[model samples]
Target chain A: MDEAAIHGILSRLLMAGTLPGSVKLGEHRLAEIFGVSRERIRKVLHRLGHERLLEIVKNRGAFTIEPDLREGRVVYEARRILESGMAAHLADNLTEAQIARLRQHVDAEADALRSGDQPTWLRLSAEFHFLLAEMTENPIVQRQAHELISRTLMLVKRYETTAGSACGCEEHRAIFRALAARERGKAVKAMHSHLSLVETRLRPTICVEEGPSLEEVIAHEIAVYREANGAALMAAG
Target chain B: MDEAAIHGILSRLLMAGTLPGSVKLGEHRLAEIFGVSRERIRKVLHRLGHERLLEIVKNRGAFTIEPDLREGRVVYEARRILESGMAAHLADNLTEAQIARLRQHVDAEADALRSGDQPTWLRLSAEFHFLLAEMTENPIVQRQAHELISRTLMLVKRYETTAGSACGCEEHRAIFRALAARERGKAVKAMHSHLSLVETRLRPTICVEEGPSLEEVIAHEIAVYREANGAALMAAG
Candidate 1:
């Protein structure tokens, strides 16, 4: 329905970073973009608002979400658990077809990177694990993997990529190698390390400009860094 | 809010086998139970349909999910990947507090078992590891634990208590001991083995009688499970 269409456009916008943070987003703009009705856009906006992906201001319009520190950690916490589980399953019964699909995906990512299409590369790189989860032939795992991927996406967008080289083809290469060897333990370890390395590559910091504090949203992400870097960050803000 | 309430009741019915597959759940009956209207019940039904926890027939009604052979394997495949990652994280930071919490969860399950509260015991046993995921101090791990827990709940409900005791409390206690002893490597191994054991406990041969297959209602228990099981059982189911 209209909701699905809205999801398509909003997801694309999210990926493109066209609508980030607390910018006002009118339904009319979305309607015009997709040649849809304002009513349809509103429906999708409401759905996204409920999921915390969009902030809907009363009498205003939808805006992007920005999680505080703690919430950011929640994003990573979810990714770590889900991704590692996915890696282990991939260890169990990896098929040549699945490997081929993954290879194709990585190849596409490399091509994207070479073309300097960072967005496509970023999406493909992030989706590689989900593609792996799908191959595992487990809906439960796939579902969990799906949720983690969404959360991770949000977290990555929030921090914006300070380290810059977020795409590590070698990391994917190492993961596939372990899988090829049928070394389940090693693969799981590599996956865990890969996620950590990927996360670390994004400097665990955000510059909050002069504005109303977003303490609640960021609490989950910042809980760990508080009493250490929190004070300075707040002072600077 | 009503949607959350409906999922709570639906999950209960499924896990308790009160509403087995093939049974027709009339909207009136469910609405009566929830003290809501038929219109609201219908909405809830559709939402559960989204989670794959319930299946809504064109003319019949919603029923608990029953995965076919192919879908069943997909569930396990998904869990393997998700849990493996969790196992790695657990291995990396198998702290004393976390170990204590896990042991405490196990001990409570033992007490529940001794008290002959089979349902409570079964639910708690699953929650033990899920709670363990939280102690990894990672939200990603926690969220994955939650999704995997839901699938596990569905799997256990269908296949569990068919032959074996409610849960392998002994296995949980044993794993707790390994974890408490600061044997990170062994603990991770034990966790993988524990998940494997649980997977084995599933009906090696699934026969979908008359319920909605799990993929139909994935996050059906967001309210009750979280409220009842707290963090632990929430993760397990």
Candidate 2:
């Protein structure tokens, strides 16, 4: 596999919080799993470390961060500040088409919730913030928002119960409604409160002690990644 | 000098807009100037490239970016969004002591302006936003704000005439007043308009063709860095 493919699989696996906090990602093991050289795996691991997705220890292998509630508070507060500003900006600046697109996204979130598709609802709920960031059409804002949102994803995956994610769809819709109405203050308030609520929803869960082996998790992530890129992989080959 | 010192000097030099955009930063040349190995200079250059401070061209060398007015607009819009959120957060969160500190800082700016100390006023003006970011007490917000603020410093250096920066003190005082009064919406509006006014003040100036040689700029930056770090360096030695 190429470095980007390896990085992508590892990034998703890490962000999904599937691996236990105690599991150290050994370069040799990753190289064997990906059918690549150790050097290549090492490079990708260090890159992920730089991105703060993985914790790189000198002489020790890479490990997943065990983000505590304190860190979660910091991350959520950051999102509140950034996305609130984003909300206010979009309130004043979102175009008619952009508003319609937001409405469609919120509707999709509602539909997923109604259909009892928990996974889809969760993903859409996260994408709602990302969509707002994109609509800002500012690359810097998009980049900053992407980093904070990605960090929160890890936090959400680890701390939030499955039931906790269910109510987020409505919160996202509220934000969308405020933005659509061009109510800047309301939109900012909605976003800030929604994120604060999400932060409050985080409950400490025991890291899975025996859920899945590292190898099993890696294989599953690789398979999911390949399936998602199947058509592109085929075309390239 | 260490890699960080080298990086600091180069960063300040580049951000100061002393070098013409067309000047290529050759590794060997920088190595000689800093009395470091070419490899060390190469590393610092690439690091700066990663930070978007310098552009590293394939098979060529690193060069300063020539940010146009269009790029300035995007950056200012980003600052407005992020700092507006910051202002809102501070409006709700600034403690009495923090408010006092802000008051003192604004007073200092006004004093600097009255004393005809344009340079001090300019530096204090930029630090006002940074101070607000630091007051947010959120590392993520601080990091994001620092990056955006640093980018604008470059834009301000390149495009803003000296006279244009003089009026920013009052705008900053307006933001401070709103934040001190804990007026969330007013604070956000003050910040947004202040940044918009700053952006509108940007004017295209011809890149100086013969102001100073690259060596002179680097030497001057190094001297400034040394003077700033004199105490720390002396302590370490």
Candidate 3:
């Protein structure tokens, strides 16, 4: 099996941005947590660093990266290349079961947004796309999409200009409707528009008070929102 | 500036694979050739490994991977996603200058094939797509396109696919023509057809030769391909 423990820790930490940018990750602590040898830990970190998830200096320990605007551009560009095509493929190939799953995904995203579970929303939003790619049945494309998604997450953390909300529930619902109807062209067109909105919402800055990353604020808000709304979160919103 | 040292070495190997996949590389010799520390060599090997250029292993060093049948499928899937969209983008945005450049690229590929300069042909063919992506002036899409191209090259090697001789030069020319007219739909369709040729030629094999992996093959070919092609070698094929 793959080295699940190390990868899981790295993936979660990187996704959550718990390992803040430039914050040196201590080897011993990571080893203790993962219960793996430093060698294995080093291997995984080195791999993640190569993926642009972490920055590893020779002497210094690895730290999460704070991608610049250029990188932000890269992330979006990758999305344009991958997700756009994926949207078409998904629309053309979406099964009834898949449509239900997507509805479920959108529901989760809406739930996260309603509950103010920014992290959950952010995560669910990404997973929504990732899951769509998975349905394409191409591992290579899936890997490429996953890479782009991770990079996008990293970039989102840096700039904090994600689409206006967890994923416009209405848009997801609309796309879902289009897919369910087997209208490939409509689904593809809808996907493009939806992605455009998502991309457009990702403007330049997060905030003036930007005490925390937009991710931090949104994710924490989502959690609070979740606490207040429970099932009513989406309804209340 | 980009470090030409590792890239230079790597490109040589990859281009060489287009002509011939059977090559061997020695580690100590390569370090001496590059005049770098073994550590640097290891890092480069590891990086290429991630890119699937060099199949470096814990004990077996590295080898330039020749894509078997399974890998070829992986490669083609990536092409389907990236190139199809690239063609569409090109069709929508092709300028006169861009069209001319694309023609020149096709010509160069033909010239290399005619001259039996597989390395140059290989580099040019790969760059042609990236150059088209660049014309979009979208570095983000360009970069993602780049990653896909790199992986595709590996697949070509794995499958021992002969992407065909300059016999199909007119096809490339035709695709360029469509791109120039901003026939977005036509261009996308052309790219799909073009990549289909590539996929068709790829020789599928279920065998994974039990020996030094595709990484070391990459190391040697990286060096050799560059030495053979000189300036054209600069393209990150």
Candidate 4:
């Protein structure tokens, strides 16, 4: 029932697009689903509201935020600044263990992409940058980078039409190669171009005229997500 | 009763050194002072604990964090990286209005220093860097800079011994002069040296053999802080 646990669950649901933009959050159902009290759910909702992931109405309830073009650009710009710094640091301080760990993540991303698992591919792609951040050995910068990456992921989930196309496997490999070679300028350049490519690939989805009910939206999104990933929808439950 | 308001109040008290290191927070007293319920105060205290400003125990109440040298160094390092980035960006994007604002803040810092107002001097010194961040027009960088500066302030309060020596007026003037002249290299060098000087000046206090009671400790700290700045204790009340 801690706020962090609830936040992780809610964030996962948001990433899976189970709670589409403007869909109402059913507090009672969420409390039941999480096996926590209504008050605990309220706290999670309030915290998410502060994070700009949800918009809370006075009489009604919280709804998922509809990502806009401005927010998308801002998040991507932040990612570029933070990750470019990480890449530069990693190039200067690249270690065998860190390089091995990053290669492992890149392998996993390739596997997910090969299997056409969009959700897993997206998760691994994001994890690659986080792993780069951890290699820098600065917890403060690592934390800021993680927050910006998560926000950018949320924006991507809202706008992305084709998941596998957003992150090119070769760009990650190019950046890793540059870091392994201790080319600081090349690593920074690769990171910037990689992020720019990801931003370019994100095209906003078409909006539907009629907004569906909360349960219907969640179920439909879950179905589509499961169908795309070939995984059971056990995360939300 | 919101977290933002409570955080602001606690942050100010921490900055003013009215709540010294390891002083146990009186939840009941704060609830009465803020005119809120105990639960609301607990939430704020819990959040502060997460922020490393307070240490919460299962049986014992939360106590203000006794910052260590490691944290002090880490905070200053983060600030240098962030503010140096801000200075470089501002050099490229400096406007007449921005220059005027920067000069105005520098003037305030000089006035505070001349008047021997420790609290105002500390506040303005911190605001000078924050103003530079705002001039970048990048909200994400601005937010990260604010957090790092605030955390650095917390560390400074815990370790700083000299009243008016931590931030020198001439250093601020030098940074302004460099920025006004549009010398990017000089600006970054000035900012980095200013932060380095501040870090070098922070000397930790010696630990006493006997510990004071919670109320006595808070009262004594408050008295010392107020006498140092010629301010009433109205901020807490």
Candidate 5:
């Protein structure tokens, strides 16, 4: 597999937070699993390390980040500051079409929640913030937003319950409503409160027990990745 | 000099916008000037390229970015989004000591401007934004603000006249007053308009005729750098 494909699979696996905290990822084992060389796996691992998705130790291999409440507070506060700014910008600058698009997205989130699709609801909930970032049409803001959002995903995956995120649907709507009305202060407030509420929902006492082996998780992630890219791969072939 | 010292000198020289547009930085020439190997020069050049301070063309050498009005618009818009958020954050979070520090800094700017010290006023003016970013006490926000601020410095150097920046002192006071009063909306508005005004002041027709040669500029930067680091070097030696 190409480096990007391996990186994508490993990135998803790590961000999914299925691995127990501080589980070391042996490069040789991963190379064997991906049918690639250890050097290629090492490169991807180091790239993920640089991205803050995993922690690399000297003389030791890469390990999944152990979720800490202190770090979670920092990430959530950063999001609040950034997304609040985004909310204000969109309030002033969002076009009619952009507002309409946001409306459709919020509606989709509601539908996913109503239909009892937990996974879809969770993904859409995260995408709501991403959609707002995209509306800014600013690449720099989008990148900053993406990094903070991805970090929150890891935090939420490990600390938050599914029901906690379900409640976030209303918060998203509140932010969208404020933006649609061009209420900059209200939008900023809604976004700030939404992120703060999300942070408060993190339960640090909830310890995850045994999970599937690293090999199993990597295999599942690779399969999902390949399936998503199947049509493109066929076309390329 | 070490790689970081080389990088710092080159970074400052590039951000100073004293180089002619699209000026190629020859590796061998820089190696001779810095008394470093060509490989070290190449590494610093590539690092600057990654930071968007310079552009590295494949097969060709690294070249200074040609300041474009279009790019200036994007960078300014980014600053408005980010720094506005920063202002809002500081409005809610600035402690009494931080507020006092901001007051002192604003007064310093006024003193510099009234004394007909354009250079000091200009530097203090930029530091006002940096001060607000530092107040956030969030490293992520600080980093995003720094990158946008640095890019704007490059733009301001090439596109804005000195008189335009001199007018920015009052704008800084407006932003400071709003933040000190803890008015989130007003602070955000002040920051957004301040950045917008800065952007509007950009004159695309302003063309720099000529600058010092690359070697001369590099040598001057090295001298300034060494002077600044003389104390630290003495301690180390």
Candidate 6:
């Protein structure tokens, strides 16, 4: 599989709580299931490690990193800085279509929330912020914002249990309205407040002592991967 | 050798112009010289690739990235944001000893400039900004700032010649004075202006279409690495 495909699958698993924090990734098993060499798996693992999702140890291999309280705060702090900067840029740069897309995303987020689908809701909420960053058209800021968002996902998965309104749909709508109205000050303010609400909702401390059956999780993902890409699987070999 | 040690050596060489951009790394030669396995060398290369210093190819090998004008601007933009944040924090939190260290570093920069040593001068100038970021004690910001600063070093080496005072020693002193006075506003302004000057001084379209003998350069570094670590080299294996 290509690195981006692997990255997507791994990221989804991470967000879905299938690969919980503190889980040790068995590279050999992953390689076997993915029908790829251990080297390709290692490359993917290295990329995730660089993203702070996995911690690579010498000889011991890679493990999903457990986000602690300090990291949780740091991630939010970075988000505030980057997102605030992004909101300002978006105020100046976002096109009507971009604003419309953001509104559509918020409607989807509301649907997910109303359906009580916590995972989709959470992902969409994160995506809303990421979309704002993406609209800024600054790759460097986008990359850093993505890193912060992904790491925050680890914390969210660990701490969040049920549907929460920390990143409420209404707040997202308010931020979008401000952006649509081209109110730069209001947009920045709304973004900062939204992030603050999100940060506040995170538990004071959230850590999983251990995860169950990381191997089984990998096996399940392999089945899903095969079903998703029957043709690509044959093409690779 | 450990990844950190390898990283240090490669960073020094890159900054000193010993390993120019566009130079392909010889993993086998590096493994042989370091008395480490190819796998270990690959690990280090992967780390550097993640840092954007090395561009790794699948069937091919890793090569130092040739920073373009666009990348040059992006690096400076990232620096301006991160460094300004850092200067604001440092102005409030810098200890008396930290101020002394800043003065001492600028003295070194001035000394390097006086000696007409462009490499040392360039590295020290970058180090000054890094030191400022380090004082913030925020690892996330520090890591991002360091990445930008190091990448800027690559651009400086490729584009700079004859020590044109992009990062003038007086500007470093001005920043230090602001920090020493605990003037947060002035410190941030000084940092922004300093960065602006540095960015302005870079050639508009700096690109190295070609470089000299990369193999000989790698060979020379191996000799230098061995001489510098004769004791540690024996201890490792």
C-alpha DockQ of every model: 0.51, 0.79, 0.39, 0.31, 0.66, 0.27
| Candidate 1: docking tier | medium
Please, what are the lDDT tens digits per residue for candidate 4 over residues A55-138?
888779998877666778877766765676566657878888888877888888889988888779878888888888777777
TM-score order of candidates, top first: 2, 5, 6, 4, 1, 3
lDDT of 3: 0.67
Flag regions of model 4 displaced more than 4 Å: A1-4, A57-60, A107-119, A161-167, A181-186, A209-237, B1-7, B50-52, B58-60, B107-120, B161-197, B207-237
Misplaced by over 4 Å in model 1 are A24-43, A46-52, A55-63, A67-70, A104-120, A154-158, A204-237, B1-7, B26-29, B56-61, B67-70, B112-120, B137-144, B203-237
lDDT of 3 by residue, A1-237 (tens): 136445654665576554445666667766665556777778788888776678889788888676666667656755665666676567667777888888888888888888887877777777877888788888878887787777766556555554466456677777777777877557766766776676556656633332555345435644554465576756777
Candidate achieving the largest TM-score: 2
Q: Write the per-residue lDDT of candidate 3 for residues B1-237, one digit (tens) a residue.
A: 123567655755563344234344456766766667676667677777777666776687877665556666666767766776667656766777777878788878888888888767767777777787788687657766776677666665556445453444666767787888877667766776777777777666554456445456545655565576675656655
Candidate 4 yields a Cα-based lDDT of: 0.73
Pairwise TM-score winner, candidates 3 and 5: 5
Off by over 4 Å in 5: A1-3, A20-49, A56-63, A206-208, A213-216, A234-237, B25-47, B56-61, B206-208, B233-237
Show how many residue pairs clash in every candidate, following the order shown. 54, 0, 39, 0, 0, 0
**Candidate 6 chain A: worst-modelled 10 consecutive residues by lDDT:** A203-212
| Predicted candidate 1 versus true structure: per-residue lDDT over B92-191, tens digit per residue | 5677777677767888998998888887887787677677766767655665556557756766766655447555888777667766775656766676
lDDT of 5 by residue, B152-214 (tens): 888887888777778888898999899889998898889989999999999986586887888
Q: Pick by lDDT: which candidate is best?
A: 5
Best by DockQ: 2
Chain B TM, every candidate: 0.69, 0.94, 0.69, 0.76, 0.95, 0.82
lDDT winner, 2 or 3: 2
- Which regions of candidate 2 are displaced past 4 Å? A26-43, A57-61, A211-216, A233-237, B37-39, B58-61, B235-237
Put the candidates in lDDT order, highest first: 5, 2, 6, 4, 3, 1
Q: lDDT scores for all predictions?
A: 0.65, 0.87, 0.67, 0.73, 0.88, 0.75
DockQ of 4: 0.31
